[model samples]
Target chain A: MASTIAEKIFASHLRDTPTPGDAVLDIDVVMCHEITTPIAITDLMEKGMDRVFDPDKIKAVIDHVTPSKDSKTATQAKILRDWARRHNIKDFFDVGNNGVCHALFPEKGFIRPGYTVIMGDSHTCTHGAFGAFAAGIGTTDLEVGILKGVCAFKEPVTMRVDITGTLPVGVYAKDVILHIIKKITVNGATNKVMEFAGPIVDRMSMESRMTLCNMAIEAGGTCGICMPDRTTAEYLWPFIDDKYESVDDAVKDFKQWHSDPDAHYDSTITIDVSDLVPQATFGFKPDEVKDITDIEGENVDQIYIGSCTNGRIEDLRAAAKVLKGRKISRNVRGILSPATPSIFNQALEEGIIKIFMDAGFCVTNPTCGACLGMSTGVLAEGEVCASTTNRNFNGRMGKGGMVHLMSPLSAAAASIAGHITDPRKYLQ
Target chain B: MKQFGGPAIFLDRNDINTDEIIPAKYLTENSKTALKPFILEDLHLEGFDPQSDELKNAGVIVTRANFGCGSSREHAVWVFEVNDINVVIAESFARIFRQNMFNCGMLAVELPKEDIDIILSMGNVDIDIDVTNGVITAKGAGEKTFNFTLNDFARELIQAGGWLAYADKKY
Candidate 1:
């Protein structure tokens, strides 16, 4: 019988029923924030379910309102901390040691390719960057995972997004994703697993790959994944046990991208970066976008180049290099947050941190930070922000604050201009 | 189940996401009953309110197109059920919300998109869905026929009022 890369990995972990994708496969990793855990634990207790299926498989992080601003959100954070201990949940990544759950979990090795992971955030597809099948769920679903150690999911139609050829000199992975969203529009992937394959994808770094999969859900997909390869194993080797080897074996064994040749998809979208340049989202919706050079006089009040979308060390460096010899405009508050502690350390070693701080930008510790309205660097009411995070909903970052999503390069340029400006105009 | 008036106050539309049905914050309740106040809250906080004159007179709703489009919050259905809205009429529904509503006794009524607009535009006008003839009769709106089709299980569940009631009788 033939199986997709995700099905093969899920089949390996099934101990009881091996009925393909319909069966509830065992979960290798689980994550819950403070907000959801309080209720999930309550449900498990009412059902007389004692002891989590495996506390070690879960990570409870205080990301939603980290650095809890006032006494109210702080009170909620404390409840999360107490519940973490009561449930004996392990991997409770704390303040200063954590960023967004999506970015930090994979960086720390809880996720490996060819594995099935379930978390409480829809963007859990972020784990797919490592070649794993991860999706988000609700509180009740998390409760089921905590007790049964499995999640019920159907096999999604496989979509092979073949992106080959070279990207223009100034373009980065962010531009590639924005280009895909534009062609497909929103709700394009309804219920499918998008496997990004091709020469360009293989050459992209793990951090860049994560950024792509992270936005897959915006198109209404179940999840998005890439095939595990040599780079996949290298990234996992440090934090995971050496005994748990060959992380990419299943993906490579099956040649991950082969789609049954006859396998059909409900939809398809191709992106050719031959003439692409730095891009940004112009309006409230992600698909409402523009090339950096297209718009004039769009004022930017804040510039943030961080979050699960573009919060890697490379993303920081790309922006920091632009901010090197200059300062952030007086009225603008430029935020440079690395996605993980390890990435933060790497930036420090590479002098990226010095460049960012010397530019008069505020260097925040790792966190999702206002990316999903979780509150780390929220703009005041009516403030206009040019950010590298996903989503710019009406009140996503505070009441009435206008959000403009952009690539890291564009955000840095906007920081220098104190308004939404193009990077090509500022670059050497 | 949040209120006695609705097995579910049906709405029209398919692909109704959790984001459109309810704002994201209410999904974490340990008790599913807490979700009763948020249905259709996304369209207008007032429309889903029990006190809203437009909705108070009608006990159920049905819609066309993607009924609930974003987020998988079960609260979306709960809010509708709480507002006394019962029997969702739509051509299709989001996969997650449909499954959740079925588990809670919210009958998901499937029909074509054109039929749904007839029912919605004629608000407060109750229609008798002739399942056999695949027709809906909207009072003065003159034979605003519809095609009400349902899987055997969903049909049985709605007939029984909800899952708990269905299970109580069948199991």
Candidate 2:
């Protein structure tokens, strides 16, 4: 079988043929947030597996409930903290510095080009931006992965998404993904490996690439990846000093991951973003998206500008620019949460956060807060919202809290206007 | 106490997402107690207040398109089932949510928005789901009938009473 890129990553990680099903892949990096680790640690303890199967490969952070607002969140934090101390997790980050887990994991150089990475969080697909095959695993899967230090898998069929031409001005990476979801629906990518190609994807920043891969799960793909090049090296170099592996090794382990010039796909969808605007969800599905311009008078009570998707500095910058010198309207609650502690610190240094807070936005410490509807950002039964998070399912944020998923820029714009508004008004 | 498919309750809201179903925070430690309280909390802001006697009054939730969207957290399905909500009548459903529900033997029934609206506005009406007939009939309100798409696996799960119920037999 002519191995695909997904196969390459799997082969590179494969240790000696261990079991009938369990193939040990050389872990390039491991990622975790609070929720998955406590149980993993507990499982280990129950099994009397005191030490981790591997520590240097571990990167644990507390972002799911970083601020620890509720009793449950607080309990989760202490559990993670104690786990970090006991395991001596090298990349452990405390709450205040913790932003979103996936955002921080890559921003901090936990991912490298031509590497195989795993994260306990479902959004682990976010790491694919660095040219790694990353996917979020369930708790049982992660616990097993940590115990034996490898994961099992069947191969994913390759699917290519060709997004050509320049994406519109206000149309950031989020829109491209939303547009793809609109085409592919939610289950369109189910069980397929999507390698985003076309010159347009190459032009996108690593952060933008992260945004694309992050939402791959929304479409039900195991993970979405972009093959690494010089851009991958530039981003990886600053984040790590280690011999973070070489491209030659990458080429050796698996064939360079690209669709065969005439490669076949289970399905191939083309997205045209040149005319698309910043998109948002109108209801309980990421696929339930519409152009921001379409929802003119909808009453949105909340506007959330964070999550693994749009919780980066670029997201913050876009939101800040929209709300610059203006306050969120009284009828609207502008909620912002940065993705990582490093991203938050950088935002602070750049005064991006000041712009957001000064604009009357209620910012939460880095956690997957309202984006998941467990935070202060949830809406009332009849309230509407404009958010930058993935998914818009019923009761997603809080039942009766209607979600209108959009880009960070649109979210910020909607926050200021108290309704869904096009981000192009500010970005242009 | 009933397995009747119709007598739907309209929670006619748009964009009911999964994050709101079981927030990522609760996914931290897989415990029954942690998930039970927060059910549909994001769906309604108060979270799902089980103490409020929600489980006793089982009713159908009629929602807009793309209901139960996002994340494959079975917690979302369990929360609803434990709360006495067996039927999710939506114009559409996220594929994952449907799968999760089907695996657990929950009902994810879809119909046109117009039929859903008619039942909601008419109030307290009963309906019979005739799977073999490929139709759902409103109790007495002008004899409205609706069509739905029921996949084989989904039908099997619901017939089995949810994924746990199904797993018991399959395993």
Candidate 3:
């Protein structure tokens, strides 16, 4: 039978022919962060296991709540550092050198086409942009992956999301994804793999594609994947090892990674982005989205443009384009955090940091800061923030905080307006 | 993983995410005791607190669709386990949250929407679950039995006291 990309990846890893919902022992990479790794390492130690199955396959990063917000977090980081050193883990990225785990891992060539990656962070699905099968697992499962080098997975049904039209000038991948999440409720794609296809996906940059896949969990999807194409090969070429002579060779090697023409999907949904407007979440859930123009003016106290979802260099450039000559409203405290150190350095070289600073934005080091309400730029009670992050759950930024999820352009526009506004108005 | 009975507390809300179950603020602590008082504290349900006398005494929780959505934090399930919540019945659950529950040997039963509504209407009812038969019996007003679904692997994991114990035996 013809198989979807997800099925193909699963079957390649399995010894037997794969079927939907079949448990398979396939995991290429296991990753965790400061928040979740301490528990998994402690569990491993308690089990009398002194070393991980393979230290090379394990990736540990200190991204979330990094720089030690409190004594508890500091101790947790210490535990992880001690465990990584003891295990001789080669891929450990400490607090200062670390970015968001999801973004940094892919840039370091840890994720590749047709590989099955598992991480303790839900945004591990972000790696699926490179045509890999990546899903979030709990700390216990992470421990299992570390010990056994393989974790069990119940195959997920595939949902084909075909975007048929070109995105408008001001609209972004964030808008397209938020629009889809609104059409499909929070639980609409529960336990399914979302396979993105059609023209819009083909034209999207790697960073934008990552932005789309990063929030697949928001709609309850196990993973979100796109076919490996020239763009994917080109984006990974620089970071990839010396094995591949050229980008064309890498693309040629993964030629079979695409879904079969006759592949059977459980369901198919078509979305046209031609007339789609820039979107922003009006409520707590990411699905509660509205067209930027439809939302009335609501004062915002903060504006954040960074996360695994929208902290890439492209996102920084988009926000910087809007804030170049203008200052953010005095009532609003704006923040810009790049997704990785490389992206941060690129932004600094491109003078995006200077533009943000000129616009009165507080530029912070790369972290999952303020996105999970863990540390840095937390909101006070009843305060409102326009963020480029994926989730807008209640108090996601801080206690009693109201979050409006939007594209970086929209976030920058809101920062200048002190209220939700259309980015197209500020775009050159 | 056999027969078990407990008082059921109704959380009449949908999409009860992990952040609300145990907010990110409390995730720094690794101890169950440190996370106990804050169970469902951030949920901010009208007139409901997981630590209240009414909830503290209850062992089963019934909720609406997509319970335990958002974030892969298993601390959400750990918080419930520490609070003595043995089972969670919902119309539906986020995939990661359900797996997290099973990994910890806690029961997360999925009932039909109508059955969940019926259970929620009955205040402070005792629920008897038969894991082998996948049935939930509510002892209130009149005896009502509802059929639920549990995959075979999950049932085995629960019987063996979660993934760690199951792994111990299998590996």
lDDT values for all models: 0.68, 0.70, 0.87
> For residues A324-392, what per-residue lDDT tens digits would candidate 1 score against the true structure?
899889988888778778888999999889988988878888877767555567777679888888766
Specify the highest-DockQ model's number.
Answer: 3
lDDT of 3 by residue, B6-49 (tens): 88889898888898888888889977668888888778578886
* Per-residue lDDT of model 2, residues B1-171, tens digit only: 235464555566655666666665567545644566666654543344434443336455677876765564556766776666767878777645665565555677888888778777776566666665468777654667788767555565556655433332332
TM-score of chain A of 2: 0.91
What would the per-residue lDDT of candidate 2 be over residues A228-332, giving only the tens digit for each residue? 765676676655435547644444433365434564566666776777777777755678788777877678888888888889888898778788888888988
Question: How should the candidates be ordered by TM-score, best one leading?
Answer: 3, 1, 2
Residue range with the least summed lDDT across 10 consecutive positions in model 1 chain A: A15-24
DockQ for each of the predicted structures, in order? Answer: 0.21, 0.15, 0.60
Instruction: Give the Å error, residue A130, model 3.
Output: 0.6
Candidate 1 clashes: the total is 39
Please write out the lDDT profile of model 1 over residues B1-171, one tens digit for every residue.
222222113344334455546554444344556766555444522234534565555555656654554455556666766666655666666455565566555665666666666656664566555443445556544445555655555555455654434432332
lDDT of 1: 0.68
Give the range where candidate 3 chain A is weakest over 10 consecutive residues by summed lDDT.
Answer: A15-24
lDDT of 1 at B166: 40
What candidate 2 gets wrong by more than 4 Å, as runs, is A15-26, A239-264, B1-30, B33-69, B72-171
